[model samples]
Target chain A: MKVKPLADRVLIEPNPAEEKTAGGLFIPDTAKEKPLAGKVIAVGPGTSDVKMEVKVGDQVLYGKYAGTEITIDGKDLLIMKQGDILAII
Target chain B: MKVKPLADRVLIEPNPAEEKTAGGLFIPDTAKEKPLAGKVIAVGPGTSDVKMEVKVGDQVLYGKYAGTEITIDGKDLLIMKQGDILAII
Candidate 1:
């Protein structure tokens, strides 16, 4: 299924942490830390004034406090406005 | 101290869960669940094209997927654009 956001909002699929540390890994589903990385699956039209710099295939980093979580097609995804995006990778 | 967001962005201080119920309680700092409620402390100028409907002092409900987290004056704040706000309370 395709998810689209309106006016600067973005649809992101969080990238799960790739590694576990020796101290014993902290799982986001279990850890106090919020997840901060994801892949952009869809993006809204620019914020009306500021043009967005990310595209659908971009990998980005967002603030830990940014974005709203939603489940689409049973897949967890985040819906955040472009301005909340901190950086693109 | 105060934190101000830029251009349609909002600064919010999360309202911690008011109650915990269960066979046991789940702490956000421990649970896989994300925190979603907060009070608006500061708001940016509305998006250039769309005037924001929210203002500082509004109690809001955001998508569980929105906003970025930042610490200012030793307090945690979420930074998000107005569009990420799901509803105003």
Candidate 2:
């Protein structure tokens, strides 16, 4: 099923937490930091005052605990407001 | 010292954590959630591509983990990029 967001909301697929460091040493789950980046899957139309700046397929960084998590058709997703997004990278 | 942010940056004074519940029960620090709102103390002249919409003295809500924390003159503050801010309230 496809997910659509209401005004000023966005749907994202978060990047996985780092499993290893740059040196390729494996890192334990408990030592991993929360992922703060994701790919935009869908975007809302936006309210008149807050125009949408991100689009589908855009990679973005956000607050570590910004969005609500959900699973749809076995895919993990995050639904957040446009304001929760930090930057399009 | 006064703070002046670089392009698209903002300085904020976060709202205090909730210390008591509506029922007047004291809540411990561990149980308190991070403050997601603040008062803008300064704003940067935005980059040409991303115009700043928030102004000094505006009340805003931001992603809970959006900024870097610092203490100046014994006052705790947060410094964040414009992208980290969610909305003016």
Candidate 3:
């Protein structure tokens, strides 16, 4: 399924947080941290006049706490307003 | 310390998630969910022609995972681009 956000919203597919520690030991799900990286899949039109700094296919580093999670085609995607984005990676 | 975001960014102070369950029992910190709410403390200039829909002191509902966390005056706050906000409450 495909979803598009309106206005200044974006659709992102979160990159999973590392599952292994530096020692190469697998971390349990309960102990794993949330992922803070994702790829921009879709972006809304430029904010009125300011052109969007990010574009689809840009790999971005977002705050771990950014964006709303939505299920699309059984995959988790984030729908966040543009202001929530810290920077375009 | 006060921090003001630039451009379309916003500075927010997160509201803590509930520490207790419906049964009124305290949930362990390890199991606590991230908060999805915050209060807008500062906002950047409007996104070009789009006047800001939010303002300082407005309580907002965001995605559980939005915004970058920053420490200001020993308090944790979020700095996210405006698009990450789902709605203003």
Candidate 4:
């Protein structure tokens, strides 16, 4: 199934299993600074004011509790606003 | 003290005590549909694509955990994006 986000929303595939990478990927187990890492699966056209900065396949960092979780095609995914994304890694 | 929000951000004065009012005001006791009500104290200039729709003194509703809690002049306030606001009440 193809998912399309609307108006600044983004569809992300979380990389929770990337804990072993040290190239500034997701650091899930830390007590402080627990930003989640994910790959952008899809991006919305963005609002008139906020231009879309992220593109699909972009590796990004987001807040710990930034998005809503959903299961698509038996895979877990996250849907959030582009604002929830902190940076592209 | 004057607060000027920037880029679609709104400074809101939370009316938690409005639970006592009966005119479709904040019902702080409800578990479902618990949108917090507040008054806009400051408005941002807005980004290029998004226009500022909320003005200072506009009564609005927002999410449960929308903005960062702040204290100014001994008063508690919230600073959030205008998008966090659900509606103008």
The TM-score obtained for chain B of candidate 1 when compared with the true chain B: 0.75
Q: What is the TM-score of chain B alone in each candidate?
A: 0.75, 0.78, 0.74, 0.82
Comparing 3 with 4 on TM-score, the higher-scoring candidate is 4
Candidate 3 docking quality: incorrect, acceptable, medium or high: incorrect
lDDT top scorer: 4
TM-score of each: 0.46, 0.48, 0.44, 0.46
1 against 2, candidate with superior TM-score: 2
Model 4 lDDT per residue over B1-89, tens place:
56555456788898966552535655558576666789998886777767899988899988867876544455767778888999998
lDDT (Cα, tens digit) per residue for candidate 4, span A11-54 = 99988665413334333442334455679999999888577777
* Tens digits of per-residue lDDT for model 3, A30-87: 9545336678988866456455677898877665566665544456567776676777
Question: Best by TM-score, which number?
Answer: 2
Candidate 3 segments whose C-alpha is farther than 4 A from its true place: A1-89, B19-35
Model 4's DockQ score: 0.04
Model 4 segments beyond 4 Å from truth?
Answer: A20-32, B1-89
Model 1 DockQ reads: 0.06
Among these predictions, the greatest DockQ belongs to: 1
- By lDDT, rank the candidates, best first: 4, 2, 1, 3
How do the residues B19-46 of candidate 2 rate in per-residue lDDT, one tens digit apiece? Answer: 2122255466585453377899888667
Interface RMSD, one decimal, each candidate:
7.3, 10.3, 7.6, 10.9
Error of 3 at A2 (Å): 29
